[model samples]
Target chain A: MERKVCAHIQCRLGPMRLGWHGTIQTVADVIKMLFKEVYAPSGADKLMFYLAPLIVLIAPFIVCALIPFGRNLVVADVSMGIPLIIAVNGFGVLGILLGGWSSNNKYSLLGALRSGAQMISYEISFTMILLFVVMISGSTNLMSITLGQEGTILDWWIFKIPVLGIVAFILFFISSTAEMNRAPFDIAEAEQELTGGYHTEYNGTPFAMFYLAEYIALVTNSALATTCFLGGFLPPCIGVAFVDNYLNMVPGVVWFFAKVYFMIWCYMMVRWTFVRPRVDQLMDFEWKFLLPVNLVLLATGAAYIVIWG
Target chain B: MSEYIILSIFLFLGAFIAAAATVTGLLLGYRTKNTANKMAPYECGMETIGNARIQFKVGYYLFALLFLVFDIEALFLFPVMMNFREIMAGHTPLSPMIVLIDLAIFIVILVSGLAYAWKKGILKWE
Candidate 1:
């Protein structure tokens, strides 16, 4: 199964290990291995270039499976679902790098390099935001976090304190969007500027897979945001205490998806409505703005609990 | 629990449908040809040239490095956040002031790193 392939690769090549190895174990290596035996480089031989991209495109969806929707709905409910999701994303980057490198185009290579930086940069804050959520919820189990928000709207972490929660929500949303390579943050594949970006040379099913992965990731990030800050399945009203006890009447599953798609709609709005920022501006906004703001918010949340409790 | 089950079911079904669609498309759309031209890397309708991989700027690597430093530091705050109530509520002899001071020191160290990176131009967009 594709899940097995990802797990196998994920274990031997997790982010920390892969980061240390750098470009040696990247997509370029994958292509080189494939072609090490082949001699000719022309005409009908050009078709193999399509295979790597196709595989890359389809990858994110498989990883998305591991992301739990509710208490029991994930493919593999590893306690570290958050890290698993992040690792899956890291794998998605290698696919892009390989697709770009294998194409043997200058533009594609440049695009891949840009994407590598952009991904590694946003992932830091993105991972930090998840850590913040986990800390507030007091559990690494994502399902427990969603359940903690069950019943009342106030149960949601965002509603626990208006200003800090909202700020955290906004920060999580922005960093996740950039991490997923969506619009406004999708400079890696800007068609007019980078000529279709990293997938420039890909075609056929390989291209289709990468295309599918993008949309799937868009949905995945939305689902994660829904669960993390917006009260996964709980409706957006009423008292936390009242809902927590009685909301169990309706199936938790339904509430879970209702929240997930609602978040997806919000993501779609940003993707379609905004003009993309330049790469430099995106990095500046993250390092200078979002990171610092989250730090301050964390401190505030800590202080709030300290004095108020 | 039912919620997780439903999600897994939906996920598996979605993946199955996608795979089927992909296999069907591959069968229907792509031509099966045994030709040398089809196997070569596409280079905008020309012969492939030069190594595609190149060394990247150290600045990007610096950003990644800086990210790890701050990220790990942020994680240490979690235990403090969760156990703050107990620690302050006479669970441990440490006073609230002590906890706050300890956290302040950790954060100060983190911020100083940021300042160092900034002064070194590692955070610069240029």
Candidate 2:
């Protein structure tokens, strides 16, 4: 009974009373508390793997909340919105490495290495795509870009540039998917070969948070596509002067989310419809195709901005 | 602006709380239950071990190199599509021809490299 009192204080009772005594210290009545003293690993081992990834994965989405899709639906309108996102994206890689490393498994280490290489490769191309859009719109602030396309479908970068628009969309989609470690690019989480991939060793709620972080990343990536490439929160045919002006009645936030989810559908389709390539093939695709093409695309966009804008 | 500020704060706080919980759990769960024999880097549980970080096959590196080449190529076409209108604006009557020819050249360049690699059997799975 005296030992039970010490347990109630919530102090670390390592190896004190075998396993039975750990179960008696609950918050309820002493008897019920006694029954509740089901002292498991207290889930500390699993928790050790979650904190870094949670921050890395969730921070970018938080920034996305500030990026307005339409007229008035942004969280914060920072001038360097695009740069901010890039930094956030870069930051997420650390959490991924930490998760893989802290798990302390060979497969996890390999997954981490693969993830690091893949993310860095794709991030270059992704940034180029962002720059392409920013060049066309003449602003990095998502709101300004939307406003630039406010009164016309033709004003949207997609219609304005044609081929480059398609390229940018594909680049953004592919690179972001790679960044999120979705299938076809999800070599990091290849279950058949790598066990559970990076976090295979993780158990309990820590694992759950990692799962949540992935979903959050998917949502964040989709929202970014909407804001950067698709006109955020604007109707498809709001080109007419009167219609665009009058359409202001609808809240911009709703339209922003609609565009975001449409992109999410695109992302899901990619995941569902494809088989993952071998890691080497994935790397080859990135370095040979993504890097050069994005470099050219960046140059072309820059040239166009200088010549036309 | 204030709405934006509040939202940002909320997001940061949420992330902070989640991070704190995870860290706390990790700290509590850390243990050093090492057995000296089990702790070594797996010499099949024999006396000791050789170099742990053994080199993989050269083919792996070659495959990675090829991927690097192609991924960059794909990125080049992105901006062309985005700014096609500006480039083809004044050449409207001649636009489709120009677009077709430009893309044809681009595709041909990439396709040939793919063919070269394929013919060399670099693309074959071992």
Q: Write the per-residue lDDT of candidate 2 for residues A72-154, one digit (tens) a residue.
A: 55667776567567767767777777776665456665776677677876776787688678667756666777777764666
Interface RMSD of each: 7.6, 8.1
TM-score of 2: 0.66
All models, DockQ values?
A: 0.22, 0.13
lDDT of 1 by residue, B7-121 (tens): 4565456546545544555555535464656655555667666555556577777887886676566556655654665675657778878888988898888888887887887
User: How far out, in Å, is residue A37 in model 1?
Assistant: 22
TM-score for every candidate vs. truth? 0.74, 0.66
TM-score of chain A of each: 0.77, 0.80
Across B45-120, the per-residue lDDT of candidate 2 in tens digits comes to 3654343234444554555565556445545554454445555554345464566477668767876776687678
Docking class of 1: incorrect
Candidate 1, residue A283: the lDDT equals 83
Query: Best candidate, TM-score-wise?
Result: 1
For candidate 2, the share of real interface contacts preserved is 0.09
